[model samples]
Target chain A: MTHAVSNGLLASDLVKNFGSVSVLKNINFSMNADEAVGIVGPNGAGKTTLLSALAGAFQLDQGSILLNNQDVTEKCASARCNLGVVRTHQIPKPFDGMTVFENVLVAASYGVDADKQTAYQHTLNAIQLSGMEHVANRQAESLGLLDRKRLELARALATQPKILLLDEIAGGLTEAESVQLVDTIKELRRQGIGIIWIEHIVHVLLQVAERLICMDSGEIIADGEPQAVLSNPQVVKAYLGGGIE
Target chain B: MSQWTNSVTIQRWTPSSRYAIVFAGLVLVLLALAPLFASNGLLDRLTALFIYVILAAMWNALAGYGGLISVGQQAFFGLGAYFTIRIADLGLDPFISVALAALIVGVISYPISLVMLRLKGGEFAIGMWVVASILHLMVNLDGLIQGETGISLVSLNHYDSAQRLTIIYLLTLGSMAGLLALLFFVLRSKTGSAIQAIRDNEEAATSVGVKPEKTKQLLFVIAAFGIGVAGALWLTSATTFLPKTYFSVQWSAYMIFMVLVGGIGKFEGAILGAIIFFLVETWFSSTGVWYLVSLGAIAIAFSLFLPKGIWGELERRFNWHFLPVGYQVVEKNKINTDKK
Candidate 1:
């Protein structure tokens, strides 16, 4: 893939709250176009919330996000996606009434406002890349869990995203299936699509992610090279209460 | 961009579909010349059938593919009818006034939508009905509306029953065909794709750069436009325009019945449903109130047993579209092959 004109996504001092409860607390994050960052933490550590903020799913209380050096905190989710920020739900949200091909075709056509031929070409590429060509015409609701997850990835990829925010796409998968998903993520990372993946499967994440960040209570407790950050005492303490997992 | 790509032919219809096209075209030709041979009474029934189709198609497009269920479409229909007579009274050409009335009603929907679209699902349906009620009351207040006392179409007095029915029949056919074609093509375009996405899941659509509000707004206005024009034509043919009858909620009820019993999202379902409805009304009118009751019962039965509507059921079983609009992907080499 051709290099993006600027560095990838950047978020600074992001704070978000739902009513009286704060979900994300003063989080600062950044990723380069060539990097894959894995986020590991205990349940409810705000990893998904952080991803949501970046994805423009919800407005933050106070924060700024930059995409390729342009401020995008004010942009809506659709606009963010058009600017190449795409996300997949933890539970797949495929357009149920549509065929798998149509679900992805919507992304290809609207994600970048591509013409018919370009959208068709992009949809084909995305479906093939995510290994969904076999069931391309099947109604999305008919897909099993594994195929649904693959379609989620395919839909995101169809947008030609520069950054993919994956939220536990590996969740509920068998070991072999998890490894297969890792392979897809690895391929995307190799193609220079920056990835921010929130996954509990540390080993699978390790295969694809070049860096690791651990969060606790909506704030990152550790961030650095994958192995080093995973070995950090703060992260260890956060994960297992002062014991290593 | 490439020479090899130039040799590719984008397949639009299958062999059977091509045949269906020819047959449908011939039928349209026959219908266009219908007034030439048909009696006045038959021509009148045909005009009523045409109006029902126009209304049903508008409702289906809005509630089906657009996912904007609105019972308020009568607001435009009533507004269109009233505007037509009023504009005709102002000494403008009666033909041009109907078009103008349709345009005006469409404009009115822009603001009405701002207020009505805030409600979702069933609430949206009710909200539109409430708006129609307001329009019904407001039109009744106008002196020109003659309230329930009514007024005649100034243009009809210039022509006899045969000429008038012929003119209205021809006009209704042209408008219904034109609007349905436009709507069908729209459903095949990118906007159709986005509308379907919004219908499925607004959040997912937003993830892929579709603005749900903007797309829904477009559909709401388009529906208003078609219903508006249909209202104008219906009034033009009827000659007598009573605000109470013109702005009746029964129009909305009929529209909902047609689409719900026909198939909500599919194009042909609306047409088929309208045809069935027209047949029922004509054949069973001798039974009086029982006819309306039977219509209601059939609609309920269809909703329960054939939830997808009759045409939708047929399409599912046959895997076919009599009027294909929304696009489906087929591999280039397997273009002519049917899905299993």
Candidate 2:
């Protein structure tokens, strides 16, 4: 049950461009250990692209990322994961042929180099944490949308990450389910895991995140206390005509 | 302590006992008495069936369990045969030659996987074919195998045809059982889960910290090793290693047909497919190229109509599997403590 405190993450002057189109421009951000931050933006605000860069899923066109006081800008995704950085996808990508238990089992074994018995117990804990124990024996492909999201969370959590990057986990969930997920995230925060949640469900973010940042055109428009950030004039302008009020 | 002990005992037998029993029974029967029926042509055909079983199972492990569809296994098979011939010329026993040849082929295949693993989907499949063609041409150019004339295995000259055939058959059976057992152990391990995860979804697997490229490369090498052993055993029985026969595209085609017809992922499906394939070959061998045509037709039919293959269909219907690779925790004897 012991959790390591991450030395926090720092991204300086981050920039990414796909062909002639600039997706992220001169982005600077930092999140401390035990901090829960929520990222909100429009559909094409490059929220996912930023998450991918932080997770080292792809190389950044320019900028440096430091995790725990070490430069990890050139590290691969697996190397970042081994350094206790993990991220889930906006779209759940559960292994189709694997059962829920097996999916988590792989994470526990390879993510931290735990022995078989310990890995098995960790896998069980992850399944229990995700509230997916009932479907552990079922193939992941057979799961519904909510269960797929749960499986995605379970797989990420089983890696025993110090920093958990959640991308739109509550995006497509029902109101009740989003509330339940918010509770889970709150519990994880209580356990001292740093979480960066990218969510379209503003209410869920409001419930769990102490800090909130709004992005427009891939640049942070507002950053502060959740209430203050949500109420900022620039944030209001970005979500204009989208009914933020 | 009593509760802990009880749970441990239950865990011991819960998941894998039935499969272990079934696999043990099959191996015992095959090893103990299969040679007793050696008088008929049955042993000869069964030997071939065993070789196909190994080949098909190796392919299944690559594509089904590991999600790597390779059409270049014939390259290793041909290398194994040619190496066996070379080893025999150096005065080695045929059995030792098979092992030596397998080793050499395994080493050669490691570098090959690096190049082949870069291609994905249809590109990967065609890349395998291209590798096979290159290897075929290279082996053909080597005059030691007499190009198309084929090389007669010199070491088997002492044994009569039937004796040699029997020994070769036993060797193949033993190799098949060993390889199957190795695969069963691998599939039961955490590595197997990672491989299965990669097969299901590579991006998900990477998210979970499974290195897909490393896993695929290891599986590629292991599969090549198994195919190489099968090749050496095949040449020993035939007492000849013709570059044309050894390096033919037909070897790859036959393996694909076997796995596709029987079942791709299931271990026993490979055995079942191999037996069915050899039986069909026996019946249709007299039809010349029509045999290949018929095989192709059957493969197409299975691909279109029964995409999961024959054993897969049967498994779905009956919920039966001889080699079960995954574990399940069963809740037994749940006590209502509060009611009690």
TM-score of each: 0.94, 0.92
Instruction: Mark the regions of model 2 whose C-alpha exceeds 4 Å error after superposition.
Output: A1-6, A241-245, B1-23, B26-33, B332-340
TM-score between model 2 and native: 0.92
**Quality of candidate 1 docking, DockQ:** 0.53
Candidate 1 structure quality by residue, lDDT tens digits, A18-41: 888888888888888767889999
* Candidate 1: Cα lDDT at A33: 70
**Model 2 lDDT per residue over B139-180, tens place:** 888777777888888878787777777787788888888898
Candidate 2 lDDT over residue span A1-81, tens digit each: 012225888888899999998889989889886788899988788889999999888889999888988899998888888
* Residue ranges of candidate 1 with Cα displaced over 4 Å: A1-6, A240-245, B1-12
After TM-score superposition, the amount by which residue A94's alpha carbon in candidate 2 deviates from its true location, in angstroms, is 1.0
User: lDDT per model, in order?
Assistant: 0.85, 0.82
